[model samples]
Target: MESYTGKSIFQKVAVGRIFYYEKNENIVKRNRIEETEGEIKRFEAAKLVALGQLDRIYQKALKEVGEDNAAVFEVHKMMMEDEDYLESIHSMVREQKVNAEYAVAMTGDNFAKMFSQMDDEYMKARAADVKDISERLVSVLLGNGTDMGALKEPVILVADDLAPSETVQLDKSKILAFVTRYGSSNSHTAILARTMNIPAVIGVDISKEWNGKMAAVDGYTGTVYIEPDFDCMERMKNRIAEDEKKRQLMQELKGKETVTKAGRKIHLYANIGNVADTVSALQNDAEGIGLFRSEFLYLEAKDFPSEEEQFQAYKTVAESMGGKKVIIRTLDIGADKQVDYFNLDKEDNPAMGYRAIRICLSQPEIFRTQLRAILRASSFGNISIMFPMIISVKEVREAKRILEEVKEELKEKEVPYQDVETGIMIETPAAVFESGELAKEVDFFSIGTNDLTQYTLAIDRQNPKLDHIYDPHHPAVLKAIKMVVDNAHEHGAWVGICGELGADLTLTKTFVEMGLDELSVSPSFVLPVRNEICNL
Candidate 1:
């Protein structure tokens, strides 16, 4: 047996046969069509057929993954129906006198490559959208649609990587696990694997020699054993059983309140980047959404997201929480997370540079649009607005002034929106020192330990060489947390911690004693954190 390791999207175990997913290698590049009219007709006909297939996929996705996720297929349909997109294809067919399949392939490659070349991560992802539609059109033109069929049997799907469209077309029932050679933990495949509760490991470049081999996939350890011996198989089976037992026990904690040994109740919440994550958040019985990273909206869009678009997404997530407190953090851009469209100048020191609330305050119109959306979404359920990377009273006041402007705009339009509370992230050392005064200005205080630790320790968490010095549990870090907790309570504000530190089991007791009212963590950690709280 040969064992390989990578990174797991979620922790699960699966023993299955390795099935290499093959891509279509044969595609006609160019074919002369004497009848120009016939070629254009063929392109139009192929589009209609693609739409029919997309409609079925959309319906299935809606029923299987929910509306927000199902919108992937809907997006493909819109792209196919777009006048500019169709014009490009039509021009290729008419001017170049090429066949419909060739025109589609060429156009798709051009557009996809264009998006792929962009600096923004989300815009670069749109390359997948172009390829998805183009592939469907070309397949229709060629009279062959491989994406239409189901898998013959269950297997651990092996691929170099998976596109968003390819990932969605998969049959979850037959997918035992997903093994990829290239993909980040935040890739579409990784997110889908977590949402569907499937085992997945990425960045492992497995050779074809392992195909058809019986494998034991361990997501926790990121190990894949190919053609394992009887002894190895037995050990893996036992490990799987043990993990399954632990999972079953964790399931029992769902919907139960997190109470400490002294009967102190604490709210346990989930942190999410997008709306689709609401499923996993709720499944783990999160009391609410503690940190909604709203930058995803701007990141995913081709340009700055419109107010209505932001409003719909926020409203959907809020409704999904079903009146549970949903704290949406405003755009936390800059530092490692940069937006190309924002045209931010290159910075020598980005971590403490212009970011988050600084960007919003500098650009009032941009900030106003987001505030309007959040206010509009407030009507659906319990929603609160949070500002990150905050350090001063002046910045907080200016931000609130623009928020008030948006509220007035909504009122003039007679929009139905609930009165939403506002808060600031206690991340900077400046904020921590002035926590008492800062707490008095906001409805609540959320200690963002991720940045707070980085800024306080003067260590770039991203720098691997500084791993030894950058301590999350440093004495200074603990002292800052205690100070923030004490100040928040003293000034009539609740305190919560929404960072990697919140999920640390060792710190749960310390936080409880320090008077933290809430702990926000990832979905899978919700139960473990709650269970730790109960034990304490």
Candidate 2:
């Protein structure tokens, strides 16, 4: 019985035969083509094919996982169609007289390297995005295809790493689980595995000879047992049964109201990044969407998302929610969520530097464009606009002024829209202290506990070295949350928490006792949280 231990990304269990996926690194040798135009045409043709395949994958993922998760393909499609990216590929093919695959490989490497050097976390992560798209294009150019049709049984897949494109292309029905040799908690494979509710272990190395061997993967302990004895297999089967039983029980709690024992009903909502997430949000029985990270549209786009582009995305999600509240937070790009096209200046300390509301306030037209889109989408269903990183009442008033101006413009242009409620995120210590004054300026307050905790504790949440120091339940962070909740109530404004802390089951009772009116977490947490509230 061969055994290996690695990092467990999610605690779950699965047992099945293993299928190793060692992707052959296709090396496209430099070949001088006779016709530049022909190579360009070939590249364009491959691009079209890749886009079509991505669109199909996007649709499948939308139904299987949800919209926000499916949006990864949308980002890929946009990247493939990006003018700058296309120009680089075209120039390479024409000038270098190289084959389509070589041109794409070279261009992708150049762009990815540029992104990898950026200080922002999101920008740095985009290096992976470029690589994914490039590999897709190359596969299309080479006309390579996946042939797993002969496998009549489901199996746990072991791969070096699974790119987003490859992950989406996988036959989920045949996938028992994912065991990768290399990946981190935030890697695309880990993210997809969690989205699909599949158990996963990463950063483990096993002999290549283990392929096709029966194995048991223990996600909780991060162990992979190859050719386990019959006794070990029995234990895995029992664990799977226990997990299934818990899932069945969870399903029974789906329609249960999230009312406390004291008869206080707190709204349970979902935080989504895109339209795709609404499907899962609804499936998990989320009453509404509390935090829509509007920056996703900006990040997915090659440049600034036009008003109409933003309007379509917002409208799709709003209409899909069937009039349930959807609070769209206006572009929050900065401090780890930077977009390359924005050309935002590098800062010594991005977290405290120009970000969120500061960028929106400085770039009024950008703010106006998003406000116009959100307002226009409000006509389709229940919608509200929220601003992030707001540390002052002055910024709230200024944002409202611009919003009112956009309303008038839309009114004059005869564009119909709902009178969308506006709100601010109480994320900073300054906002906590000034909550009373700030609450009066907005319709509601949504405590962004991720930033709130970080700011209150003076720690960067993204730093792996600071993991031990970061505590969301710290007295200072809790005090800030209680202050925001209390002051908002005092000002006749309700408060909701739409951050990581909102999803912490251990603190659910404390939050409910503190008078938080709503808790917005990820889709998967809605039912579990609802169950917790009922127990309270």
Model 1, 1-536: lDDT tens digits are 88899888777888999887654543767888789888898677667657756865675576579888988887887888878788888998889889988888888889999999999999999999999899888876765533524567788888877655455456677888989997666456776776566789987968877778899888888888888889988987898899888888899988778998889999999989898789889889999999999988976554799999999999999999999999999999987665556878656577878889998888878988899899999999999999999888888888888888888888899998899989999999999999988888899988888788988999877553565587889999999999999998999999999987898888999999999999998787899898899888
Q: What is the C-alpha lDDT profile of model 2 across 1-536, one tens digit per residue?
A: 98999888777899999988764556677889989998888787667657756765775586579888988888998899889999998988888788889989998999999999999998999999999999988876765543343457999888876655456457777888889886666566775676567889987895678789999999889999999999989989999999899888888888778898888999999999778889989999999999999987886665788999999999999999999999999989987665657777656578999899899999898999999999999999999999999999999999999999999999999999998888999899999999999988888999998889889899876554575677888998998888888999999899999987898899999999899999999888898899899988
* Candidate 1 runs further than 4 Å off: 5-11, 19-26, 29-90, 93-101, 104-208, 219-222, 338-340, 345-350, 459-471
Instruction: Report the number of the highest-TM-score candidate.
Output: 2
TM-score of each: 0.72, 0.76
- Which model scores highest in lDDT? 2
RMSD of each: 10.1, 9.4
| lDDT value for model 1 | 0.84
Q: What is the lDDT of every predicted structure here?
A: 0.84, 0.85
